[model samples]
Target: MKQIRLGLYQFGDRLIMRARHDWIVWTLVTAEGQARWREERRFPLTVTAAGIVRDLLAS
Candidate 1:
């Protein structure tokens, strides 16, 4: 199994979660940013927004 890691940070009022495999990056933003990501990016559903990102990257 490959190890998956998540990087977290806070910018302004939003929490950003990044899932990276090698050089590819999938960004998941939460709070107000999540709302915008859902609207504009059509984010997938999961237990949480961050979970969705984690799962996507793991796959």
Candidate 2:
């Protein structure tokens, strides 16, 4: 089974943050945390359009 850990951090302007450990995935749904990842702007490590939509609907 796959496990995911989500956390929040301080950053600038985005909406979520994703982090991974060993084989587990984590998503930090917050403005500051998201902003940090966005500013980095990396592809494979970046946010997914579909994921954002799914999260919105779930929320």
Candidate 3:
């Protein structure tokens, strides 16, 4: 199995996740931030980042 590592940080009021694969950095925002973003457009609230990585890996 290959090991994967992620770096997490907070910027202002947002949580950011960063992972490096090869020479590229992949960035993802916490679910709450995403929700707020959607809410700005009048979209319904949805899942957060709490279980996002697990859910994606399980799928």
Candidate 4:
């Protein structure tokens, strides 16, 4: 299983998602900027895109 950590920082109008896994980081910030939320859920990406969406929406 891959480990994922999500960090949300309040800027002006963007929800910044900083995710780190295995020393590699991926980031995405919402253009509208909303309150952030995060959780660790185990799912196979090959099985469904829902997991990807879920992680993003989880904030």
How much lDDT does each candidate structure score? 0.43, 0.40, 0.35, 0.43
Q: What's the CA error at residue 41 for candidate 3, in Å? A: 21
Better of 3 and 4 by lDDT: 4
Better of 1 and 4 by TM-score: 1
Candidate 2: the clashing residue pairs are: 14-35, 16-34
lDDT of 2 by residue, 1-59 (tens): 22233343434433434443212233334553332323222343225665566668889
RMSD of each: 12.4, 12.1, 14.4, 12.1
Which parts of model 1 have CA positions greater than 4 angstroms off? Answer: 1-46
Q: Put down candidate 1 lDDT per residue, 1-59, tens digits, no spaces.
A: 22223344445434334433322233445556553231122233454556668889999
Candidate 3 lDDT, tens digit per residue, 10-54? 344343333332122233355455422211112112234434655
Candidate 4 ranges with C-alpha deviation above 4 Å = 1-47
For all predicted structures, in order, the TM-scores are 0.23, 0.23, 0.20, 0.21
When 1 and 3 are scored with TM-score, the better candidate is 1
On the 0 to 100 scale, the lDDT of residue 36 in model 3 is 22
Report backbone clashes per prediction: 0, 2, 0, 0
Better by lDDT, candidate 4 or 1? 4
lDDT, model 3, position 54: 57
lDDT of 2: 0.40
lDDT of 3 at 15: 32
